[model samples]
Target: MKVKIYPIVRTAAVAVLLSGVSACSKMYDVKPQNVVEAKNTYQNIYDADAAVTGVYGKFLGLAGQYEVLNELRADLMDVTPNAGADLQQINTHNVLPGNAYADPTPFYSVILNCNDVMKNLTIMHNTQKLTDADYNQRWSDIGALRCWLYFQLGLQYGNIPYVTESFSDVNTVKDQSKYPRIALADLVKTLIAFMEALPYKDPYPAANSLITTIDTYPSKMFYVNKNCLLGDLYLWNNDYHKAAIAYKNVMETSTPNGPGDSYNYYNTYTLNSGSDNDAVTQSAWLTFFSRSMQDREYQTEWIWSMVFDKAFAPENPFINLFANSGGKYLVKPSQTAIDNWSAQRQTDGTPYDYRGINTTYKMVNGQPVIMKFLYNYVNASTGIPSDPLAKNGRWYIYRTPTLHLRFAEAANRDGQTKIAWALVNAGIKGAYDDTTIPDPTQRRITNLPFPYDFDARKLDAPTIRGKYHRNLGVRARVNVTNLDVSLQQNANFLAMEDNIINEDALELAYEGNRWQDLMRVALRRNDPSFLADKVYNKLLKDGNPAAATVRAKLMDPKNWFLPFN
Candidate 1:
């Protein structure tokens, strides 16, 4: 649980972090370094240039923490015998204050680093060391990261100490009188306000962008997906209309080729004539988590990914947590998760979700292991990774499937249930041609009003085609059977919402999102059982000894979060 700092960090960024990652939450509240060091560090464009990248260095330390906190606590994963007490506590929902994984220190380390960079960047701008364009780009990029980290903190820890200033000393963070803890809702509103007010909402321009040498790993992969983060904030705030607009903006983002580029990934993989026949060849669905971010589809699909290379000194933390060999193998896919994936049929008339059976988790010597992190790392002939010393891969932050799922969630809550249901099982094209809605005009996707607007008016021309006409729904992409919307018999919003949540698990399990997905729905419904029941069921299915106690504790809602101190 004690993840190391990224060894591949920029020199200036490392200098910033030498001070600490324990800062106040507000921007410019305090200078992270003393006046002399601040003057020395923020003197020029080079120092200014390294500031944002430095925060990312600290950010990389959070690789496995996200997966451990998010999935292990949720219903999708279970701890193996090798799992330490910290992981065991997390699994059974009996985490104590001293639990290493429960410590909020690493998270604060990234936040403090963000605050450090933001504070210096502002000073450099005011002093004319950086131009308006340069300052705005760096400032907003770091700000978006801060917003995302804070939102995640709130999601995991609930009412947390929300500090925004740069803390010169680590002990300064304990002074709650100076920087008070706020409710998660308040934090959401604050983040929403902060992000919406930023001048630049898009990816950094060519000159200011964080460019990677490898083409498949796009510049976009290096930074936070600001719009997706905004969409999440709005969704959690229950402003589904605003959330839909935010998500729609991401879906409608133009290609790198000057806004006219045809491919702006909107769940656009085709359902071919041989779609159901994964019986003969490899599945494209599994490529979403491949070793290299090497393909064009990967370019659009990976909204945000934190990559690591052992040769470069940055390494994949999840390899130890999820892998069977050359790993601690502390975690495995839960029986409940396996059962859920097994219940669905792939397009090939197969009995399981292709992403589930062999792709996500596979048996090695008859033991089920999470293969997602180790898939391409392992050799075809042998079951172990090629370079076993230190692993290299990426941790998924947000992706296209998550984008569509979230978009569907927002649309559903905004009273667009049919659209939401379709997004789960079929594409928007299928949503439009819904069997229940007879009229073409009323059901047509092109005519849908603003907030629910996704233009599929022109299917022939690639430029004009819109919102999933080229796309299939989340489940449809994997060729699963259609989700039962119960549109005719019971047309329930919450039920359809439940369907979306269930789809979220089936599509996105072990990607560091399960707990948040389930928790968000449970909170919205004001029903603890919405989350507790599923968690209890997972424990029951796994035959956990503390199932009853865990269920009782989770029913209180307060017990859902970890001990942050």
Candidate 2:
């Protein structure tokens, strides 16, 4: 029982002991064990700091399952022939209690870690070693993380036990009866309150210095920033206008040079000022996902990303399951994803969208495979790990483009079509028109143009909708005029909403948000037909009746939330 808590305690002890160890000494030589040592682990501010870091470690550990459960059920992925029964169950939307990916224990473990930190936070601060600013930052960090975990729990397994305290007795831990599951809506309200109390920025020390020397790659936005969770909560709550505001606040306050760094986005990634095939565009795209931020010194566009170390943390399983060198390679890109990127063309029709060339997927033995998370760790030509043991790369939770799209979605829902069009266009144009590119011709990716200035009287709404939806390949099988007519009526909003849904698929595929993206529209519009029309129609397009049955089961609102393990 205590062993479950030992990792957190030992990690803290290591952080404290390392302060006195010789610069050449390894910190892992001494490790703490047992309840007494765990009780005494955080006797100082440094120890408390380490415990807070442990919270992040726990969060990172959940990324693999988190992504799998979120993505596999969505349409972007297809279970490979090599995928095991567990993976198959996920792809079919038939998750069972024993499925490792569906287990809630890892997420609960993170909650417990946060509880442990909150319990001891005061003692560390009262000792005078911790400043008020640092204390507030840690408070926000712990609260936002808890809110995020709870939000995931609400989305995945609705009606989760809302535990906020640590239990020292192993025997007492078995008492689930004491902590009954709360409704998802009630839990979301609680999460909103918890997150709103947090400051938007950590605003202490230098910007890039928010992270420790040991974790040089993480953005402070990953921990201290709160708006990502706030925006997520608002979006889920159907507060579209508020969600737009929340996301806008984050974008405005965000530093382009990563969360705490001094540099802005343009400086951080340095838009490639070269030809479409130039090394600059290639490097910029690669560096955005790679560790060391392409040596830019900070994360510019990444809102929050997980950190990994070769010796301690688990490597990203997305890489492990997708990289050819990763052996298992259990998941494959759907034809939907392949077509989404490949179908794009420049105004002149020259296969103009190179964003897909090496950024998202690439041909391997004449089979198109996902390339986003694979490129940083594996060699493109050989399909082998650049380093057999390489364990680090950003696992994105939020980034600039997704936020842009979300804002666009919310704007469209609010009846601000011009705003929606402008946002969608800007997000795409921004990606292609990066001034950092030395050659303007090299920077272009899509033929789509920005929305004409907002004039309802002058707007060609149907054509604009068609262009945006067509560019992203999101329209349902229905005709454009039909979609446009549906767009005009509040009752037929799902047809219109498909535009954002498809855009999300096109722009944010395989990033672990697709299921929620599907659920969001489904839940908001109270339209289970979306589940049948978009998901099953495209995902089960191969004519599998069994898959069709699973889609029917999934359409039931109860199945929208995951089962408890």
Best-matching candidate per TM-score: 1
lDDT of 2 by residue, 364-421 (tens): 6565567777656677655567677774555678765677667767767765554454
Which portions of model 2 show Cα errors greater than 4 Å?
1-39, 126-129, 168-176, 199-210, 215-224, 254-283, 427-496, 542-545
Q: What tens digits encode model 1's per-residue C-alpha lDDT throughout 1-565?
A: 1121222333433332222222112222334442335566677666665566556755776777878999999999999989999999999988887898887777877777777778778888898988898888889989999898888889888888877776655445556787678888898999999999997788776544354333244444678878889999999999999998988887766533234434433332222112322222335667667745645556656777766655443357777887777888899999999999899886667787877877888887678888776765665334577778756677778777788889888988887887777667766676575447664443437366776665443333334444545556677767788866474123488777878888888888888889999889999989999899988999999999899889999999888877666
For each of the candidates, the C-alpha root-mean-square deviation to the true structure, in angstroms, is 5.2, 8.6
TM-score of model 2 (CA atoms): 0.77
lDDT of each prediction vs. the true structure? 0.72, 0.58
TM-score for each candidate, following the candidate numbering = 0.88, 0.77
Name the weakest run of 10 consecutive residues (lDDT summed) in model 1. Answer: 19-28
lDDT of 1 at 552: 94
lDDT of 2 at 356: 60
lDDT of 2: 0.58
Q: What TM-score should be assigned to candidate 1? A: 0.88
